[model samples]
Target chain A: DAGITQSPRYKITETGRQVTLMCHQTWSHSYMFWYRQDLGHGLRLIYYSAAADITDKGEVPDGYVVSRSKTENFPLTLESATRSQTSVYFCASSPVPYEQYFGPGTRLTVT
Target chain B: DQQVKQNSPSLSVQEGRISILNCDYTNSMFDYFLWYKKYPAEGPTFLISISSIKDKNEDGRFTVFLNKSAKHLSLHIVPSQPGDSAVYFCAASLKSGNTPLVFGKGTRLSVIA
Candidate 1:
């Protein structure tokens, strides 16, 4: 597809296990972001990448790690999942100052 | 502290009526604001945006008004339709580039026919 896509639309992992959510975009946007949406909190940015090999933390980056080895892929990893980390995760891509195009999202459940 | 805040948790509006959603921010450095709409199981989709330089920006039946002095902004939907019912989120950015957006809690809009 030409738009952004996320894999493992839904996931359930144990507390001590590591989980990774993948995001890929065909548009090759320069900017890619990861956000977690929870009740009472609309969307909190976890991490963002400006380009390949350039990534930075966002509002809520603790306990979550992100890396962008290529322009089309940005993956978020949870070293050790926690129950509080259960929330819907969204990936978005944008070109400079333009509006973002969001992926369908991945729902992660930490048990 | 939350830089962006949407006080209303939900709103009910009759079809063909105007739907107004308000947003407030504590950061004065924010220069751009945007509104996004999301369905039950989908990620938010960009609806409209307004820059700090302008007080208002309109597109079709949607209009966004920015009051920089008050650190407030609002999204107006005229003649709202049932299809417009969704969770709306307000976001702000310092400029662009590497500055990640700060989003407010979404407002669920229910447009009744």
Candidate 2:
């Protein structure tokens, strides 16, 4: 596929453990984002990166960590995951903020 | 506080009818609004969008109306089809740059045939 992609479509991990979700975009877009979808919360942004070396926190960034060392790849890591962190995680990219392209999403469950 | 809100959790519409999904935002700084559709196990795909400079934008069967004064926007699907059944989300952003989007809770639209 020529669009964005997420690895490990589904994941199960124990609380306090660490897990990382990968997002790759072939478009070489300068901007990338990590968002988690919960029942009533909709899609809350965890973090976003502008270019390869710059990153910023979003609405819910306390438990998640993200890095964009390369423009084509942005990875989200959950360090010492908690049960409340269980949700569907999506990665998106855009050359501009007007239109964003999303990956299939990763379903992460912390038990 | 949630910047973007979709109060309705779900909506049911009969096939061949019109389906309207509403969204509101608290941030007046948001200059762009967009709608996205998601299937059961898929990521959201962009549907349509309207800029703050314009009140309405249309593409085929989908039309997005923005009420700047009300700080609200809506997506209308005319003659809804079964294929339109999915979770629809409304999102907003400051502008088209490095900024990230703020999304609504999403409304599940079920088109019954």
Candidate 3:
């Protein structure tokens, strides 16, 4: 209730289908981020929001979209899912620029 | 290019022994470094952090040493226990900015009893 939480802990979708991963935080942190973890890549930032209605791309943002309509919600969308996009997605929130708290990641599989 | 790198994919150590996990960063702009521990099927949690100004920071049995000149850092867990077995990740961020953290691939540490 006081930390970040992600919806659809596990998801299986077909290629070319649209998918959205939801992230919510109760802390009302100013910064929220989305990252994907792969076997060799570790965790690469996809997108981040400094505050509501303001979003920016990170290291890898291709084929992915993110939006922060409210202080507590940041949702990531996959316009057209691909098999290569399968990975564990983590959402994190930070009150400041330094420390971040992560939610239980959502494992996504594209077939 | 990978700004942060963890050379070791996995490491094994005896219980009650020292466990050292190393990390290297190529970017000189990074001034803040952090270590995180992740369990299976869960997101990583922050363990410790050190700024570029300070070479060492300690918390409980976890200590992080930073070598700015070498662009390297290490996390030392003293008297490591089986419960400490997990994937450890190193991350870096700019000193004064909104830049997101760059993470290393992570090293899986196992403390055998």
Candidate 4:
């Protein structure tokens, strides 16, 4: 398609295991982001990438890791997954800064 | 601290009635506000947006109102439909084109038939 897409729409991993969530945008937007939606926290940003090889920590980034070696892909990695890390992860991209388009989402469950 | 907050967790409205969703922000630097609608198992989609320079912005049956002094904004849906029964999220940003947005929790709206 011509929009953003995410892989492993659903995942289940054990604690202490490594899991990676992939995000790709066909638009080649400069800015890409990862957000986790929780029951009470709403949508808390895990991390974001302004461009290729440029990534920054967002509101909540302790247990999560992200890398953007390419403009079209930004993947989030959980080096050591924890039970609390379970949540629906959303990948978003924006050509500019204000309006952002989101992908379907990846639901990850850590047991 | 939570910069943006959505107090209501869920709302129920009858079909053809008006659905009013409210949002509040504590950040003063945020000048741009946006509302997103999300359904089950899908990402949030953009619905409407309003800038600080204006008090209100309207699009079709959806309208957004901003109150700078009160540090609040609201999304009004006229003649709510069952299809509109989804989670609504309010987000804010600096409009500087550099910073990321701060999003509120979200409100689940159910348009009862």
Of the candidates shown, which would achieve the greatest DockQ relative to the real structure? 4
Report per-prediction Cα RMSD to one decimal.
1.2, 1.1, 0.8, 0.8
Interface Cα RMSD for all candidates? 1.8, 1.2, 1.2, 0.9
Model 3 agreement with the true structure over B5-96: per-residue lDDT tens digits? 99999999999999999999999999899999999999899999999999999999999999999999999999899999999999999959
C-alpha lDDT values of all predictions: 0.93, 0.93, 0.95, 0.94
Deviating ranges (above 4 Å) for candidate 1? B96-98
Error (Å) of candidate 1 at residue A96 is 1.7
CAPRI rating of model 1:
medium
Candidate 3 clash pair list: none
Model 2 C-alpha lDDT per residue in residues A1-111, reported as the tens digit of each score: 698999899999999999999999999998898999999888988898878988999899998888888999999999999999999999999997557899999999999
Q: How far does residue A107 in candidate 2 sit from its true spot (Å)?
A: 0.5
TM-scores of the models, in the given order?
0.97, 0.97, 0.98, 0.98
RMSD of 4: 0.8
- Clash count, one per candidate: 0, 0, 0, 0
Give fnat for candidate 1.
0.59
Tens digits of lDDT, candidate 3, A1-111: 688999999999999999999999999899999999999889999999999999988889999999888999999999999999999999999987567899999999999
Off by over 4 Å in 3: none
What is each candidate's DockQ, to 2 decimals?
A: 0.64, 0.78, 0.75, 0.83
Specify the poorest-scoring 10-residue window by lDDT in model 2 chain B: B93-102
Q: Estimate, for each residue in B1-113, the C-alpha lDDT of model 1 and write its tens digit.
A: 98999999999999999999999999998999999999988889999999999999999999999999999999999989999999999999888443767899999999999
